[model samples]
Target: MKRIIPLLIFCFLLAGSGCANKAQSGAGIGALAGATIGALTFKNKASGAAIGAGIGALMGYIVGNEWDKYDEKQVSQTLEANQSGQTSSWTNPDTGKSYSAVPSPAYMKQGQVCRDVTITEDGGEQILAKACRDEDGVWRLQQ
Candidate 1:
């Protein structure tokens, strides 16, 4: 029961944090599940939970980061292929999440090509994003 209370509190905190991005959300979820499993499987519950959380968080971050990359790839493609004011849309084959991006006119920023874009997720909120083209002509997303 003592352990359970902390777990519940952790869950509440995780929920309250809003997560913001896939990587953060993944780490929180992984830590929670790892703690639970470690507590059950090991005699030294604290050590077990700590170790499990570290490992789980690493694995989760890798997966979540990959998803972020995939999303970024789509964004980069859209930015490169579509003209300003035209919207490009796609569904992630792995996650089935659909998104659409509408890019504004390109502008020069510090000698590089940059464009502001709006991305909308199906049934979700829209995100205002920016991408810049590098010397190599690759479009990179900016925070």
Candidate 2:
């Protein structure tokens, strides 16, 4: 059917998009699911799909952002406990994604304690990340 072709294409695109990041992956998945539901639930399939996709994307972004926060928390904890050059590792219970971080020595930046870290994901790509501890002693990832 005509509808089936587009849906299949969308799914393929979604699969590729998921590789980007959690927020993006969530949006792609949400849009696909929303479009399917909207097409089935509404008389005007096109309009319904559009509206549903928008709503779904927003919701998905929120959920995905939370996941990001959770990951950041883990990274912060690792930085707090491990010594410089010692790798700290953890696996996310929710996503089964594993990460390891090796933090550099703590240094002062603009009066805040900061550390540079190398974080490896699933033993594959490694990303350099930075985190700083505030007065309240919470370690926050620096952009």
Candidate 3:
């Protein structure tokens, strides 16, 4: 039964991502399936429901968190791509006007690339932005 619960949850999670429905709904469906299987296999409906709920919540949390993080990384990568060494005078895409940003020591890599930097704008100052060598070897900020 324990083994079955994991396999069931794995299938549900995969199915959920491939599916275009709501996360809570998908998790609820998985939990229902888990509970049904557990009760039938072990003859304990209460325990089965508890176990099903716990496993469902865990899987849902992981999938939700990973999806959010993946989005953030992509946006960060895009910003880093667009602003690498274009010049001291770069306009922030967010504000349209120029902002001052300076690359920290992190930007200086002997061989590897520096990227995903954030800049604060000020009066007439040259702003530094995050920049990276894109996969194509050309440095772009909005990759």
Candidate 4:
């Protein structure tokens, strides 16, 4: 019962925070996953859960903090509203990371609008991505 109380408190805090972005959501997911893994892998379930939660939260924060709604909007607007050669750029106020996206001309694929784009992050890292417009008219990045 005592162990459950701490976990409940943790969950309550996570829920109360509103989890307005990916980082918060990641932390919540990581905490749950870590707790499960820790319980299965260690003799001291509570201690293991605590350690796992810490590690997982850090990892999740790092991964999920990379992008947010602003970044998504920048990419989508650049692809949908501009010409092939046009580029769009934005800087994240919280992280100080700058991003730029350049998109190729849109083409039709299986009744969907598709485009290829190159995104530069922090002025050095670059990623090539493909995106397609869905039935709801939202552009989604392809895996």
User: In order, what lDDT does every prediction score?
Assistant: 0.77, 0.78, 0.50, 0.76
TM-score against truth, every candidate:
0.80, 0.72, 0.32, 0.61
User: What lDDT score goes with residue 91 in model 4?
Assistant: 90
Q: How much RMSD separates candidate 1 from the native structure?
A: 3.4
lDDT of 1: 0.77
Q: Rank the candidates by lDDT, best first.
A: 2, 1, 4, 3
Local lDDT at 2 for model 1: 60
Q: Residues 34-134, candidate 4, lDDT per residue (tens digit)?
A: 76677668798777777777677667666666656667778888888878978888897766789999999888989999999998988896888899999
Q: Which candidate leads in TM-score?
A: 1
lDDT of 1 by residue, 4-121 (tens): 5575457436634743466666666777777667777889877777677667667766777777788888889888888988998888776789989999989999999999999999
Query: In model 4, what lDDT does residue 130 have?
Result: 90
Where is model 3 poorest over a 10-residue stretch in terms of lDDT? 85-94
Clashes of 3: 11
